[model samples]
Target: MRPAHGPGGAARAGDLPVLAVLYGRGAATPLGLTDTARGRCAVVFLGDLGDPLVAADLAPVSRTTRVVDTRGLTEAQLCALVVGLAPDGVVTFSDSLLRATAVAAKACGLPFHEPDTADVLVDKFRQRRALASAGVQSTACRLIRSAGDLAPALAATGLPAVIKPRAGCSSTDTCRVDSAEELAARYAEFTDGVTRPRAYVLEEYLVGDPSAVGDFWGDYVSVESVTRDGDTRTVGVTGKLPLAFPFRETGLFVPAELPADLVEQVVRLERRALRALGVREGVTHTEIKFTPGGPRVIEVNGRIGGGISDILKRSSGVDLLAHAVDAALGAFDPPEPVLGLDGSGRRVAFQYLVSPPSDACVPGGDELLDDLYDIPGVDLVDVGITPGWRADWRAGTEWILGTVYGSAPGFAELRITLKAVQDRMASFWSEVEV
Candidate 1:
């Protein structure tokens, strides 16, 4: 990989800035980013060990790696660690650690989403209230603490409501329950087992534009923007593939092909949503839907869109990971991403590898990896689950067999590349054993 040049273009000798980061999955992505920004790494680990793939990268690049379970510590203790590390900036890309990172960034007086607002961004219930209170046009939502609350919540939101943990990402445990019985059962799974947020949120369902089906557009889109000192700048909007029902994201196509008017409308709605959340600094991923009535906000995340960073890099000539480092250091102010529509424009996408229903038998095995890697236009592949892991379809993103990243000269070509690979994988799935 080529060394990433900083916002200043280059770094002088003895100019290795240090950054303290909260370690999470894909730590290498961020660690490499800091290195490209001409900086050293220091990691704060929540678990006893970091993700193995990331740990390997962290070893050589990180100046100091501490295993501090911030979950057990108070805000002051976490703050002390940040002040003691005394790095130039602090950050974490993990949705699970955004609030902690924001708190530490605040204690260190670094540029990040303000700690108070960060909490609101992490909690969907709070996020909904904030958006609606600010007149941002959001769905009516109810917080559910137990099974007893399900009926009332359901009645309030009507049928086909969305249920999810108050705080989570990757669409984990998110589902659309159409009946009261299914709603109660789903709520029980969370309350009785997962040990997640004490309360889950039930929200009125927002449908997508009826005409979007033929365009292959998902029910919603996300605006990847950066906020600097209370000002927000749009990076690009992403067009999602049909979600894997209930709510699993299959893929994302960047520089979404939307009419000029709709693009402006989305940008304006995103700006209003972010302002309501008080997201004054750092990057944000805001998901919005084009409902029959108008655009409605789905949710806002105070970080970069996870795997879509590659798509952004390819389609817009912007390295969002590197841009994140620039944001942390208070030196980021790049113009909005420039997208092209001609065949000359770059088109990139990421397709998650997921299994069919568990009872379904499938074929192929370790050999499938080779086939995926051999596919043309496939640039990167990461399998979260190893062979013989007993794929469980109910595990949400946890069941992700892997992901394939690829790019092409235009959206049409990109779709061909992705479809070819996906179809090949499907063939293997049909013959493999469960």
Candidate 2:
């Protein structure tokens, strides 16, 4: 196994180390880890590409360290790289990769979280089943491995159902089907590559206002503090605004507009759902809908929610990334909420800078980042666009053009500011060509 270097530029041959496996290069998990430890610890980068910031983030910690770049490697090859790292602990944000890593870690006699819990967190179908059996209010769902299984599943699930991949992220292969014919047509779209057999899930369509709660669970109960055994801290909540079809996220407003009672109810539901899934420790990103009956569970992710965390921290003055890493390292203590702030009643919005379809134009991320930074009270501006990456304007994925965050005095002021910023951004995009 390759030995990583400590913060002092010396080799960590016989010392305990923490391993973080990232699914993609642009993800915020690594950055979160770095912020939490402040380059005082060791880390490993596992992904197709390495972000310059990731290297920059770790450079201050140590000059010489083990970094296993897993780009273009098969699963077995990747496993070999992880084994070579020989880490005492492993951390992952990708659900699929987490499951695989858990198996490998267990076989190598490493103490780690179980894969079944991770599976239940990632696989929407499995999560729904577990929640339903545990008496949690969840949307009706059926797993369909083939077209042969589609009919029975549909009959069991009624009309206006949502069809999506069982383990997919970013709502990549999701579609809403109102009838059997629509389901067949949508199913045909998934007939290639990783989705060929198209192991899909059909769920009863839910309609209502949507919200997200970012929580952390401990050994005994869900709390705001990290436990000795890596229990997590449940922090503030952020309300999500999604686009029309496939439910791609559009914007996020910190500190949801719901009443205090509703917020408590949502928290209780999150605790119940996590307990049922056996997720004792770690961050949870849960999506739900406030229906006519009440709040219903949509899906729960074991890791933190992408992009939303930035807004939560920006508005609430709490760093979720730092807390997550501290919790994972058993050095976390819940900080008191930044209370009596004037920003609570105001709406702080994060709008995605997306390109419109027509010209194959690419966004000038650096320039936009600068513009957002210059804005007064702008909390964070994350540009997810990469050079040479094609932009499908119609694609129902959260490819943030850029995020603009700021607070308004009230809902009316929030609306005006949001529109003004959005219009300014739209004008900027109009001037650019493909």
Per-model TM-score, in order, reads: 0.85, 0.76
Which one is best on lDDT?
1
lDDT of 1 at 2: 20
Q: Please report the candidate that would top TM-score against the real structure.
A: 1
List pairs with backbone clashes in candidate 2. 216-234
Clashes of 2: 1
- For residue 33, what is the lDDT in candidate 2? 57
lDDT of 2 by residue, 9-103 (tens): 34666544555444452236554655554553466656554556545544443334344555567767776766765654455666657676656
lDDT of 2 at 270: 73
User: Taking the tens digit of each residue's C-alpha lDDT, what string does model 1 give over 186-299?
Assistant: 777766755554778999988778474345557678898887788777878887776665576677777776777888888899999888889899888889888888788888
List the global CA lDDT of all models. 0.70, 0.59
RMSD of each predicted structure? 5.1, 6.4
